[model samples]
Structure formats: C-alpha cells, structure tokens
Target: MREKIRSGGNAGRVFVLVAVCCAAAAMPLTFTGPAVALPSIGRTLGGSPLALNWVTNAFMLTFGSTLMAAGALADTYGRKRMFLGGLAAFGLFSLGLAFASDIVWFDILRALQGVGAAAAFSGAMASLAQEFEEGERLRAFSVVGASFGVGLAFGPIASGLVVEAFGWPAIFLLVVALAALALVLGAVFLRETRDPNAAGLDWKGAATFTLALAFLTYGILQMPDVGWTDPFVLAVLVAAVVFFFAFYRIERSVARPMLDLSLFRYPRFVGVQLLAAAPAYGFVVLLILLPVRFIGIEGMSEIAGGRMMIALSAPLLVLPIAAGLLTRWFAPAVICGTGLLLSAAGLAWLSQFPVGSQPELLVWPLLLVGIGISLPWGLMDGLAVSVVPKERAGMATGIFSTTRVAGEGVALAVVTALLSAFTQMNLGPAAGEHAAGAAQRLGTGNVAAAGSMVPSMARAAMLQAYNDAFSALLWLLSAITAATAVVVFLYLGKSADVIDGAAGEPGPLRTTVMDP
Candidate 1:
C-alpha cells in the first residue's frame, strides 16, 4: 500500500507539472500569436490605428495589472481552485475573441482574456511550489521556462500559418483548446494548496496600482494621436501619477500589502526588477514591431514574415538552457548583464539594415538579439525570488512577473508612439499637417492608408520616412539596454555569495538557475 501510494503521488506530480507547463506555453502563445495576426485582424475588422493597437494593449494592461491580485487570491483560496477557475475564464474569453465581429468587441474580450491569464499563470506558478521540493522544484520551473520558450519560438510562424489557412479567429481558438486541456488536467491531478497563515487580499493596493498602470498606458497610447499638450492626455497622465502615489501610500500603510514597498530598499531586489523590465525594451517590443514591419509594411507574405521572425525567436529554444548551465561558472549578474549588452549590440546592428533589406541580411542581427535576451529571460524568475528572503519569495515572484509584463506593455506603447513621432519628423515639410495622421497609419502597418492620408507624399518617400524612424528607435533602445545592463551588473555585485552565506546553503544562483 505504501509503495502504491508513493507511485500514485509521483504520477500526480507529473500531471501537475504537465498541466502547469501547458498553461505556461498558452500564456506566451496568446501574447505572440495575436501579434502575428494583427495585420489580418485589422484588415478583416477595419479598425482605426488606435483601435488596432488596443487589441494587444488591452490584454497586456489587464494581465500585468491584475497579476499580483490574482496571486494573492490564489494563496488565500486554493491554488487548484484558482487554476481551474482561471482556465475556464480564459477559455471562455478566448472563444469570445474568436467570434468577435468588431474591433471594440475584440479589444474588450482581449482584456478579459488577460485577467484570466493572470489568474491562471499565478495559480499555476504557486501550485508548483507546493508540488515539488528544492531540487525537483528547480527542475519543474526550468521545464516551465522551456515550455514558455517553445511558445515564443513557434508562435509567430504557427500563427501565420493558421491565419493564412483558416483566419485570425483560429489563433484564439487554438488558445481555447490548449486552455481546455490544461483545465482538465489541473482539475483532476492538481492538489489543493493554500497559505495557512495568508492574509486576505489587499484590495486597495491592487486597485490603486491597476488604475495607475491603466491611466499611464492610456495616456501614452493616446499621445501620438492627441499630441503631448492635449488636455485629456495631460489629465490622464497626471491621474496616473496621482494613482501611483496613492498606490505607494496604500502599500506602505496596509498590513498585508499586495506589493511590499520595503522590498525596494534592497539593491539586489531593485536590480532584479530593473532586469525584469530590460527585456521589454530590448527584445519583447521587437516581437510585435517586427511582424508589422515585415508583413504589413514590407509586403512579405505571412509565411515569409513568420519565417523571418523565427531567426529572432529560435535561439530561445536552447540559449536559455545553455545560460542556465553557464551559471555554474559565472555569476548570474555577469551572465544577465552580458546578455543585455549583447542584445544592445544586436539592436544597433539591426538598425543598419534598410526597411526593405533582404531577409538574409537581417537574420544574423535578429538571431543575436534572440540569443542575448534568452540568457536573462531564463534566469529572471529565479533571480526574482533570490533577491528576497525565502519567506518573501512568493511576493517577490509576483512583483517580478508584474514588472516584466507591465514593462512590456508600457515599452510597446512608448516605442510605438516614438516611432510614429519620429516618422512624422522624418516626413519633412512635404507631409505638412497630415504628417501625424500619416505617421499613425504607417506605424500600424497601413502603408496604403497613410499614403491616402498624405496625398503629397509618395509611397517611396513614406517608406523611407518610416525606415529612418525605425532606425532611430532601434538606436535609442540599444542605448537604454546598455545602460540598464551596467546598472543591473553593479547592483547585483557579490550579492549571490551574500545570499548563499546568509541562507547557510546554496542560494538561488546555485539551485534556481533557470526558473524563467
């Protein structure tokens, strides 16, 4: 009986890991797949540029903002309960997204899908902590990371093929199927786990933080269309600041805060957060922008564009695992910093290519960026909890994931706006007052629409303007990435040794090398 029980437990654990890994892959698949389908969606639904951007932004904003709250709820309730609930919600929302006839409906459904994703992801991660022990836990998390990489590696090409053969709706339908499978596995095999001493959810802190992020994203996304000095834009931006201040105050005051403000006091903790955000500017933005540039602007077929994207994402399949192995001989900080620096070089190299440059010419730079970012991507989850005490690992994980996703959403908005602004500037006096409108259209990959708006500008001239703006954007991103790399390296100095000594055992650097 004892042996039988042990065997059954092992079987259950395997199923749990499989379920969580499925959820992990589904998350990135949802993120990157829709990106590839963006042009198709826009063409089918006939939305304005801003509306189209919302399809991606809405999902990211809700997902990033609600993650901490979802984690808290998962702990207070049962992890299994939250995981199952999240999966159901996600599947339902995905179905709605598939059938959405208008862009507005699609954006709304997308936001709902993000909320579901946040809950499912938080629950899935929290459940892993319960199902596995120290060494086994590390391996479990690494498997999850690899699963995420698989999604990123193939999402674009898979999405392109699906969109071409079926339609954009098929992309969301695929997510629904994945979600359903995970949902069933989780419901049957996952154990119910909760924090026995968990405090109730911090509703106020969650609200304030969500509001702050929402307002900030909204203001930034609107900036290009309404201009910097527009009254409503100014109001929303100010509101964002106010809400952020409120969030800080609330977190400090609350007995059980969603995010512990005191964590920022630790230099290593701060460094981890910065590192979490670095990839957003350095790599994540490209996932979206490159697809638009390749298929929408450059007129590459969907399959051709997806194939090009493989160069940017394929390295993730192996580089993350390779980075994990290298950590045995190198400090996590050195590895992470070096990765960002490498990515910066790739960005700069990529900027040299013209808009219509040959696909082969662009491959090396894109591959370099992929390889560089994969190093940090693999270790960020481990580093997040490592920078804090073991007792605080759950909080630290929530904070890091939130930072990473929120940072991506904000980076996408900022880069897109900057690109539009730069394009307008590069248009010279020829486009005149219509420059902003034309730039907006061009930024969304609606080159023909932009030409229609700016009748004075030739197609060739518009493309040149966009190309110059893209180059400027890449250079700016490279500088920012390099600077961030230096700061992350400095802040994480010798802290790994300190953490290990304090714990009186192998710290996260030694044990949790690749937790995604």
Candidate 2:
C-alpha cells in the first residue's frame, strides 16, 4: 500500500509532491492560456507590443534564472523548507498580479512569480527524488508527468471559464487559490530532504549565473523590437556571453560548485539537456501562435479559441502514461524517437492547413502533436534524475528545469521574431511598414483592431501574412525537432538504461539503479 506521510505517510508524501510539482509546472503555462487575451489586455491598458512581450518573458526569465540557485539552496538547507517558502512566494505574487494596474508593474510581479516557481518546482522534484527509490521513483515521475498533461489540458479551459465568468484578474485569483492549496498540502505532508554533504552557498556563482541568463534572455527578447544589430541589444548580448564564460570558470574552480561542470561530459546527459530544451522551444511556438490562429484569422472569440486548444491539450493526459508504461519494454530511443517523428509529421501537416481553416479541422493534427510530445515528456525527466546521485537531485532537476523554461522564454522571443519577420516579408514594404500592430492584433484573433490598424490594406493581405508566418514557423520547428530526434536517438547509445554517471566511462544499458 502507498503509505501516507504524517497522516498520509510516504504515499501521501509522494502524492503531494507530485501534485505540488505538477501544479507548479502547469500553473505558469496556464498563464499562457491568457495569451488569448493579451491583445485585449494590451489595447485596454494602452501597452506597447514590446511592453506586452515582457508580460510573457518576465515569468520565464525569473523562473529559469532562479532555478539553479533555488536548487543549490534547497540542497544546502532543506527541500521542504525551500518549497514551502516558494509556494508562499508564488501565491503572494500571483495575488499581487490581481492588483497590478500597469504593464511595468505587471511584468515585475510576473518575474516574481517565476522566482517562486523555480523554488517550488526544483524543491518539490528534488524532494520526490530523495523520498522515492527504484521502481517507486519511476512511478512517481510517471504520475508527475500525467499531472502535467492534465494540468496543461486544463489551463486553457479553466482560463476560458474563469475569464468568461469574471475578468482576467480572476485568472490570477485562481492561480493564487491553487498556490495556496499547494502550500497547505506541502506544509502538511512533504518530507524534508537535502544533500547530506551539501556545501556552502555559491553566492557569486549564483549571481553571475542569474545575471548571465537574465541578460541573455533580455537581449533575445529585445531582438524583434530593436532589431538584432541595435547597440543596446548587442551590448547586452555581449555581456551575456561574457557572464556565461565567467559562470563556467567560476563553476570549474569552486571547491563545491552550484553546478558541476563535468556533467556535460556524459553523452546521455548532454542529449537529455538538448532534449529538454528542444521540445520546449517548439511548444512555446504553439503557445504564442495558436490563440492568434484561432481568434485572429478565424474570428473566433477568446473562449472558442481556448476551447479549441483542448484539442491540443487533452491528449497530453493520456500519452505520457502510455509512454511511461511503454518504457517498461522499449528503449527511450524507440519511444522518444518514434514520438518525435510523429510530432514532426504532425507539425508539418498542421502547417499546411488553410489560413482560415475551421478549428474543427485542427483536431487531428493537434492530437498528433500532443501525443507525440507526451511520449518523451516524463521519460526525459526520469532519465535526467537517474543519471545523477540521489544527493544531487536538486542540481539535476535544477538544470533540467532551467533548460526547459529558459528554452521556452528564448523560444518565444525567437519564434515571435521569426513570425514578425515572415509576416513583414509577406506584407511587403507598402503594407509592411504599417503591419506590425496589425500583425500583432491579427495574431490574437482581434480582427476589429487588426482591421483598424490597416484599414487601407485588404483583410486578405493581413490574413495571408499571418498564414505565411505560421507556416514558416511550424515547418522550421518540425525540421529542427526531427533532426534533434535523430541526434538523441544515436547519442543515447542504444540502451534502456542511460543512467551511468560521470565517475565511470559510458557503458552498456542496464536496468540496475544508478549509484551516487
């Protein structure tokens, strides 16, 4: 029987850990669902596109940068303590957003929300890695994956329902409520875990790492607005590169580093890291483009667009479980490889849909993409953790979490930049000069504003621009993802078990539990 911790024992502990971790993972993404309303929010608040872009990047930036530090502290102090604190912080910031009046203040609070998620996700996953072992550990991650799927599926639906009932602020209120629930559960049942040999805090390393990531992300986010060669963007990008170099050197010299630089030497570890980031980059495109495709081109309401997103989200609930169980027999390559191929195929096919295709036409392709992504979802998380010693769970998960979220942030910026470029190219100079605002409006499916932005341009021309941009976006993502699948399949080195650590030479696959 699964034992409950305190009242619930170990089973209860695991349950809460999974629940809390998945909620943390899924909650920020649920915020993405509100992107359906971003154009409206921008117009209503009189915010510029650049300022509104911050609204999205802010959460990703803080969440990704803070993860490693949060992991280090959780390892040094106690995972449970860090988690409770993070949950508290996340809930508070989410509450604060409900009161935010301006774009700047909203972005600031969103960053704080990312910070909280960093702590909560890293701490919660590390705690699970510590508390569970062998089969149970895999089982726990499977449940965690499933929860993520469900939560992702639910985000848009919930956003639609809540936004329909109240306003966008109500969405933050729901986040606050969910965060509070997680906090209560975590406080009551989570079992504390930390590295027994946890070393001193790496304050300098943490600062440098955070700054490097923040600047790197900032530069990337600024690209579309300021153009890539703009002096300010160039300077920040240069600083990001320098800071990253400093971070690498500091990590190498430290007696006990926040991040062990040697981890990259392992082929599987490297592959896992890439795998962590690649899918995330592609997924972020969907988050940015879908609401626009459904609402902007098709002239659907935000609620209808959200409901249609369920087509993409629902399969997440099942496919992860299927992939997890399939791992009992097949290698990660066969599972993840096949899934990636399918995902790429789905994306390529989806890209071909007519510009003004009905939401009903998207269901099959969305399902394909969802299932394809789900196949590799949990397997990767488990593999990354297994490759490290239990004591370094926080660090391992920290790296994984950072790459995934940071990839999302950078991906959004890159994809948005690409979308903007393609749209501009298709619009041509005459219409293109005036297309930016119209394109942005079109993306969110706000046809009224889009029409207003380019009254002289034909609605057909605007729709064509969005279609070309989206087609380019999806085709590019599919090719890249398919290529990544090839790399991961080959580099994973033909094994069901790729958990061999850095202390040993890479060897054959084995099902035995990995050692510290």
Candidate 3:
C-alpha cells in the first residue's frame, strides 16, 4: 500500500510537469507562427520588413538573455511562486498583443511576453530537475521533449485556424487563454522546491548579462540589412563583447553569480551543451525554409504546405521517446551523436533540390530529419544536467537555455546573410533588373505591383539561391555534428554512473516532493 501510494504520487507529479512544459513550449511558437505573416502584417500596420523582423527578434532577445537570471531567481525565491507569476505575466502580455492596434505596440508587448516566458520556462525546468532526480529523470526529460514537438507541430495549425476565423489578433488571444489556464493550475498544485543552499539573487549580474545578450542579438539581427561593417552594427557588437567581459568579471567576484562559469569545466557538460545548440538552430532553419520552399515556390496551398510539414514533424514526436528508452541502456552521447548524424544526412539530402522540385520529392528526407532532430535534443539535455552539481542545476539549465536560444538568433542572422549573399551572387547583374526590381518594390510596401512582378528568371534565380543556402547549412550541420562526436568521445569521457571514484566528491542531487 505504501509503495502504491508513492508510485501514484510520482505519477501525478509527472503529469503536472508535462502540462507545465507543454504550456511553456507554446510561448515561443506564438512568435514563430507569425513569421511568415510579417509581409502581410507590415502592409496592414504601415511598417517595414525591419519592423516585422523586430517583432520576432525582440521576443527572442529578451527570452535568451533572461533565461539564466530567471532560473537563478526561481532558485533564490520559490519555484512555484515564480512559475505562477510568470504564467500570469505571459498570459497578460499575450492578451495585450491581441489588443495592440499598431506595430509598435505589438513589438513592445511581444518583448514583455518573452520576459514572462523566460520566467515560466526557467522556473518549470528547474522544478522538474529538482523533483525528478534518479528513477524518472530521463522519462521526465522526454516529456519535456514531447512538449516541444507538440508545440511546433500544433502551433501553425492553431495560428491558421485563428487567422481564418478571427484574423491574426485571435492567435495571440488564444495563447493568452492557454497561459491563463496554466497560471491557475500552477498556483493550485505546484509546490516550493528552491535549493536550501541557493544564494540570493544577483541583480547587477542579471542586468549586465541582459545588456550583453540584447546588444549582441540586436546587432546580429540587423546584420542582414546594415552589413557587419556598418559603424552602428560594429559599435553594438563591441558593446556586446564588453558587457560580456564585465558580466564575467562581476560573476567571479560575487557571492552568488547569476551564472556559474565553472560548469563549462566539465567536458560532458560542455559537449552536450554545444550539441544542444547546433541542432536547435538547425531545426529552426529547416522549419523556416521548408514551408517557403514547399508551398510558396512549389505552388502548393498554405494548407498543403503545412500538412506536408507533418512529414518532418511526425517523426520528431516519436524519436525522443525512443531516445529516452535507449538512454536506459546506451550512453547518452552515443545515442545523441547518432541522432545528429542522421539529421545531418537528412539535411544533406534536402540540399539537393532539383529545378522545379516536386513536394513529393522531399517527403523521405523530411521524415528522416524529423527523427534526426528529436534524438540529439532529447539525449543531450539529459547528459548536460546530469553532469552538473545540484546546487548549480538551475545555472546549468540557464546556460543550456541561453546557448540554444543564442544559437538560434545567431543562426538566423548568419543564414539570412548567407542566403542574401548567395542570391545576389547567383543573380548577377541581370537579376538587378529582374528579381531586384521586384523585391525592392515589394520591400518598399507596394503590394499590388509586387504581386504582379514575379518573373520566371527571377524565380529560377531565387530557387538557386535557396539551394545554395540549404547546401551551406547542411555543410555547417555536418561540421558541427562531427565536432560534437569528437568532443563527446575525447572530452566527455565516460557516461554518468559509470564514472567510479572521482578526484573529489561530487555534489548530491537534491530531490524534493511537490504537490501534483
């Protein structure tokens, strides 16, 4: 009877944790689903492409920077309190977006939404790591992974439905309702689990770190427009570097830093963290390109394009569960490494799009990519957290979160830059009169003329550019995946639990019971 009760309690906690992750995962997609709609949004709001880009970039910049600080705060205060507070904030801000009349207000509200999301995600992850230590950590992590899959898979569908039913504002409003529901549930059942030894919040460290990340991300995002050599961009980049330096100096001297730099000293921690970022960014690229390629270029309807995406996303939902099961027997790195390779291979296959490529041609590679994306993300996260001391688990989570988001930001800029360069180079002088004229007219906010300006030669040139971009990204993924393998083999050493007597005593992983 005692064993049965204990099992029931653990099961209930897992259910609550999964629900929290699902809600947290949905936050980012609120931005992602609208990325393609930016062209239309800009026209409606009398804004520019730059403004639309900021709509997405603003949320990402804030979310990435605050992740570490938010995790620390959760540790310092109380996880459950922070979690509910964050959910409420997220809901309110998302609701604000639903009422935003213009682009400026939309941008402002999105930024706030990001802060709230950072808090919620950081708090929930910290709670899960604390709650599930030994028997169920892998399973718990896989649930988090499923939340991600569900978020990405369903976000577009929700956005489409909302847009069709009540326009774009409805999309934001729906998220608001979901977040509000999460807030209520979190407050009702969640419990406090802050580490006993967790130190006070370091406000100075948080501010400096936020500035550092914000400046860096802003500069990177604007790179496609201004070019990296522009004085303003260069200045911001320098400022970003300086802030990071200052942040590190402050962290080292503080009693309790927002981030613990020492975690990187562990090879498994570093390797797994690095592995996490590459694939995280890689999938973002795939998601962005596949829709445009399959639907916009291939003459498929929006619904058809979205449905085709299932070819990639369906497998994403399943592979993580498989990875979780396999991790019970195999080394996390080995399983994760295999997944990375598979993803790279799938991407390589996708990079070979023929002229006037058919949507059916892409099904196999997309399905493979779906599987590839899931495994690395699932396994690497477990490996990273397991290596860290429980005292710094929050910090570890923050670091992993920060890097993955940062990687995505940097990847967007780099990929956009590379694609622009390729398009320009491939188009040559003739494209100036062909594609350039049309793009310039469209970019300048002329909808009607731009709609009629599509030229065959321009389309061909753009497709070539896309092919080059995809190829370059595949090469990048291959290099990153190979390096991850070497790092895991050489630096990461043995899997956890397999490592016998260490040079020093490792910290005990603190486990806590919480109300479901």
Q: Which candidate number maximizes TM-score? A: 1
Q: Which ten contiguous residues of candidate 3 have the minimum total lDDT?
A: 497-506
Candidate 3's C-alpha runs over 4 A off are 1-15, 18-22, 129-141, 292-299, 354-356, 389-391, 431-467, 493-516
Expressed as tens digits, the lDDT of each residue in 179-200 for candidate 1 is: 9889988877776777766787
* TM-score for each model: 0.95, 0.89, 0.85
lDDT of 2 by residue, 1-516 (tens): 212344465657555765566465556454565576665566556566667777777887788787888877887778887888988888898888877888888888989988988888777776666556555666776667666666677677677677677877788887777777777777766666666666857998888988888888778766665666999999999999999999999999999887887777667777778788867755656865787667556767768878877877787778777777897899877788788888898899899897768667888998788778878875777667655555554466668878888788778767776776677667776565566666655544566766786788887877888788888889999998899889878866544354453322123211122121
Clash pairs, candidate 3, are none
lDDT (C-alpha, whole model) for all candidates: 0.87, 0.73, 0.66
Off by over 4 Å in 1: 1-7, 494-516
Top model by lDDT, which number? 1
* Alpha carbon lDDT at 445, candidate 1: 91
Question: What is the TM-score (0 to 1) of candidate 3?
Answer: 0.85
Candidate 2: the clashing residue pairs are 3-10, 3-11, 4-8, 4-9, 4-10, 5-8, 5-9, 292-443, 295-445, 296-445
